[model samples]
Each structure stands twice: as structure tokens, then as C-alpha cells.
Target: MEKKADQVSVWCIVSMASIPLVMTLGNSMLIPVLPILEDKVGISSFQSSMIITSYSVAAIFLIPVAGYLSDRFGRKKVILPSLILALIGGLIAGFASWKMDDPFTMIIIGRVIQGIGAAGAMPIVLPLVGDLYQDDEEKASSCLGIIETSNTFGKVLSPILGSIFAAFLWFLPFFSISALSLISIVLIFFFVKVPKEKDEPVKFKEFFNNTKKVFKAEGKWLYTVFLNGVLVMLILFSMLFFLSENLEKVHDIKGIKKGFVLAIPLLLLCTASFISGRKIKGDIKTIRLVMLSCLAVMSIAVAFVGFTNKKIILLLAVTSIVGIAIGALLPALDAIITENIEKELRGTVTSFYSSARFIGVAAGPPIMSIVMKNFLNGSYIVAGVLGVILLFIVFKFIKENEIGNQTEKA
Candidate 1:
């Protein structure tokens, strides 16, 4: 029987939710501060973006490995050490910003370490949520939605916090991440408990063979879902970067005002995720419909962002629509992928999906920096075109039964 949200362990929910909240704070918190970092740290536009990219680049490579290790060793063992690594990274960056004459490179290195920690923590939370609920599909879906909402919630908070911190000291955002990570570490260590399972560890050779078999059987729809994830994230982050830079460069809106403006879309996104997660509830048809509809909204809204430069309100209206689209898209992707994969391989499979998403994250800032520098409108054009393409791919390939069968099994 399905359980209500309140019936789930409160501590498990809190601990699970904290993982994404902290991860988002670690990364998205830097968005509003990127422009300031360029001047304070003596870096170019592209170099400043690398502070974000360095973390994602490391995460994109290590995430799958972390997933596999989690499946082998259990989730908490991997998670605790990962939290420590993230704390260490934050400390390194915070110290460099305080003491070093040339701290930019050191900060980037610290971000890379933070990314490694991220690989183990946030991505694992999906499967860990799946593991927590076992056969309780209703609770899993609800909890997954809440977890995703937490991720978006962090985004909602990051810009405002980053702006506030950077206003005082340019490096305060980095230090704040350390404090946040420390809190998550304590919560997870004390509050989160992974339910035990009796499955034996598969040998690497057998594991590869099974993964390959699963891919060969499911790669078409799986690849489409993976690509869709990449496209959505790429568009979202790239546009955020563009918006952040433009607010400062064009509108002279900096500090807290800019942070509030950035938060507008993210707030909408966060609300959408919370509502979508509750409404979707493991239904396959709902997943496809919501994803497609959201992509359509995103495409048109992004295109509009390109055309309207003079009116901040117009930009806010369009970008808010883009936020809603992204907000809905994420939880749907998580539900579909989680439902489709087997329990034993869920971590590994989702890790690869997370890695694909991180590739978009890693690429977004640099691409935005380059495109915005050469032609400001080009970033929106790219976002719109990619959305259209991904929408088409999903419409054609992602089958209802593929999702239905998985949901039925759950």
C-alpha cells in the first residue's frame, strides 16, 4: 500500500532533502557573484566562468564512479566522506580568498574538490530515495518530488545569499558553502539511515555486461531522456549566466537588486517543481505531457528573452516562464528515469544520467560567456533551438509502455 508523505520518516526526509540543498548552494550560489569575481579576482569573463565549470567538469567524470561505489559499498559510507571532501574544498577556497595574492587558481582547484564531493552526494540522493522507500512507489515519488523541490529551493536561496555575501566580502559565498556543507554532514551522519538489502555485489566484468545489456535494451528512450536532461540544464544555466551578466553590464543592477531579479525565475522554478512532483505521482502519461508542455514554454520564452533587452519587466516575465518550464521538466525526468531502472542498477544508471546533466552544467557558463560576448541574442537562439530539438526527440522516441511498465512494477 502507498504511504502518505507524513508517514515517511521525518529524519530520512530531512537528511535526503539536505543533500541537494547543500549541493545547489555550493554551485548556483556562485552565479550572482560571477561578474564581481572577474574584477576582484583579476579574471576575464571566460576565466570567471571556469570557477563554476571546474566543479562540474570534475563531477561529470566522477559521478558515475560514485554511483557504482554507492551500489557496492552502501550509500552512507560514500556520502559521509564525500561531505568531508566538499567541506575541505570549501575551506581551501575560503582560505585562498582570504590570504592569497592570486587566489583565482586556488579557488578553482577547491571547486574541483567540491565537485568530487558533489558526485557522491547529490546524485546518490535519487537512488537513495528509491532505496529508502523500497516497494512503496507512492512514497518514493512523493519523496523524490520533495527532494527535487529542495534542489530548486536551494537555487531559489543561492542568488539572494550569494549576492548578500558578495556584498560584504567577495569570497563570503565560498565560505558560506563550507558552513552549509558542514550542516548537511551533521544531518546526514546523525539523521539519515539507509535500509539494508541482501543483494550480493556483482563483479566488475559482470556489472559492465549487465549495464551494457540494459543499455542495449533501453538505450533509445534512455538516450532521449538523457539528451533532454542535458538540453534543459544547458539552456537553464546558460540563460542564468547571460541574465546575471546582462543585469550588471546593461542595466547597472548589481548587488541585492540583481539577486532579487535572478531569484524571480528561480522562485517560480522551485514552486513548479514542488507542485509538479505532487501532481505527477509516478504516472507515465503525466510525465510525457508535462515534459513536452514545459519544453514548448521554455522554447518560446527563451526566444523572447533574446528579443527584449530594454525592459527589465519584460525580461523578468519571459524568464519566469522559462523557470516554470525548467522546474517542471526536472522532476518529470527524475521520476521517469527512476521508475524505469532496476533497483540494483538504479544508482549506476542515474549517475550516468546525472553526469549527462552535469555536462550541460559544465558547458553552460562558458558557452554563454562566448555567445554573449560575440552576439547577445545568440544565447537565446541556441536555447530555443535546443529545446525544440529535444522536444522533437522526446515526442518521437520516449514510449508510454516503457514508462507504464516501470511504474506498474513499482
Candidate 2:
């Protein structure tokens, strides 16, 4: 019985690790090819941006509901269906890119479907990890950290992979993403084993009542921190999107050179994530310090990007600093949420976190694009202001609760 239990635990951890890989690979693989799609599909810059926004819009709205369903039904049930949907969306996008007369619109539609499916998969995975670990907060946190690292790894490799695929054919990246989604589906179905809920199903009224009770619980501060973390992610992505556009349009950088330039900050981010994963051993204060410091530095970087014409060296330095901060912060934030929330309510809270992130992801690009294009005083001013605001929120509102308390330690 002991050996069997150990084996089950190992399998659960492996299954949990797979979730982030799927999510990260699907998204990251598309970044390098955005420029290509714009040219190939004959879309405006703003319309090209919709490829990202459409997916995020769907994810923002759908993740909370998906989280609730996962809690009510089971993680495996939700995840399996999500995989199928994602696969279908990927195939549609690929086929559209391959044959459709209006490729961009079809691609966006397919991405929206993919986002809807991802809503069910990505957020629930962390909660599933929490469910699997039950009492082991440390292990659960470590698992979440590893999952985050996998995500970063995917991001790190995505540009190179996307470039290679795009070199072969504009539509190949979509097909590659589809293949990965299908593989993920098979892996989860065969390997993951979520335990069925022992409690009887609660009615809708009772569900809301329970959720309200949970919200009113003393440790709501964690939710605030998580939300702020999501904001930080938005700001980071906004900066990246703006930078990418500026590099291509203003600086005349394109193709693989653009990919390489964009990759610099991600390398720093990858390093920071790795170091944080090794050192962040349940110290909430330490985690907060790292996160806030990164945001502060990121603010400075944004300011720098606005004024500098040196372009290559200056942008690289500032973005590298910002990337490091983001890398250290994300896993810490995720672990905090996963470790602090109660098991029964984990899905709901994680879903909320996902929603916040999706909101940021959806809003970041267009908001930055508007600020950069219309607000002539220099767009970096807007980015800098956002960074400063985020820093203030993190310092003033995000409290570091006691680490071991799972009930209300937000």
C-alpha cells in the first residue's frame, strides 16, 4: 500500500508538470511568427495584434467558469475536453492559414476557440496539483514552481522554434502547436488520475454562498497580491509588445534579427526563474522583496526605453533587468496562491488568478499600442507610469501573510 501510494504521488506530479508545458508551448510558439502573419495575411498592425487579444478575451471570461466546473466535475474531465478543443482550434487555424482567402480572420477565430479550451486546462492544472498534494503545501509549491519553469523554458525555446517553422512555411507553426496539443491530450488521458470528489454536489445557491463565505475569510490579502501579480505580468507583456513593434517599425529590424533581439530579455527571465526556484523555500517576505524590486527596476527600464536612441545595448540592458524581475516574481506569486488557498476552494481562487492574468494579457498590447501611437509625448512614458503604479500597488496593498496558514494568508 505504501509503495503504491508513492507511485500514485509520482504520477500525479508528472501529470501536473505537463499542464504548463502544454499551455506555454501553445502560446509561446506563436510569438516569433506574428510579424510573418501580418505580412502574409495582409492585415493592419492593430488587426495583427488581435490574434493575441482574441484568445485572451475568451480566456478572461471563460476561465472562472471552467475552474468552477473542474471543481464540480473533476480536473481530468475538464482537461481532456480542453485538449480536444485546443487540438481542433489549432488544426482549424493551420488549415485556414494554409488555404483560406482571409487567413487572419479565420486564424483569429481559431485562436478564440483555443482560448476557450485553454481556460479549462491552464487554471485547473495548478488547482489539481493542490488537490493532489492535499496537505503538502511545500511540495505543492515546488511543483507549481517547476511548472512555471517549464513555462519559461517553453518561452525561451519558442522563438527559435517558431523561426524555424516560419522559415519552412508560414502555416507550419500552427500545425506544430496542434501536434503538441494532441500529444498533451494523449499524455493526460493515459497518465493523470484525479481522485473523485467525496462530497455531494452543492446547488448553485449553495455554491455562491460557499464562495462568498470563502471570500469573507480573513486572508483575502492573498487574492489582492495575486491580482497585482497579474497586473505586473500585463505591464511586462505590454512593454514587450511595444518594444517589438518599435524595433520593427522604427528601427527597421525584421526576421531572425528581431527574434534574436527579443530573446535577450527572455534569457534573463529564464535565469531569474531558475535561481528563484532553487532558493525560494516558503519564504513569503523574501518572495515579495524579489517581486517588488523587479517591478521597481522594470519601471526604470521602461523609462530608459522611452529616452534612449542607442537602441540595441540600452534596450537589451533595461529589458534584461525587467525580465529577471518578471521571472523571479511569477513562480513566487503562483506558489503563494497555490499554497495558501484551501483545497476545496483552490479551483475557484486559481481561476480568479487566471482571469486577472488574461485581463492583463488582453489589455496590454492595445493599450500600449494606443499610448504609443496616439499619446505623442513618447509611449515609454505610459509604460513607465504603469510600472510605477504597479510598484505602488505591490508595496502598499500586497501584504506578506504567514506562509504556513492556508486559510487566509493572502
Taken over the whole model, the C-alpha lDDT of each candidate is: 0.87, 0.74
Report the error of model 2 at residue 311, Å: 1.5
CA lDDT for candidate 2: 0.74
- The numbered model that scores best in lDDT is 1
Clashes of each: 0, 3
Residue 182 lDDT in model 2? Answer: 79
Task: Write down the TM-score of every candidate.
Answer: 0.96, 0.90
lDDT score for residue 331 of model 1: 90
Can you write out model 2's per-residue Cα lDDT over 314-375, one digit (the tens) per residue? 77787777788778887777777777666766788789888888788777776766776766
Candidate 1: where is the Cα deviation over 4 Å?
Answer: 1-8, 404-410
User: Tens-digit lDDT track for model 1 on 156-215?
Assistant: 998999999998999999888889899999999887767756777888888888777778
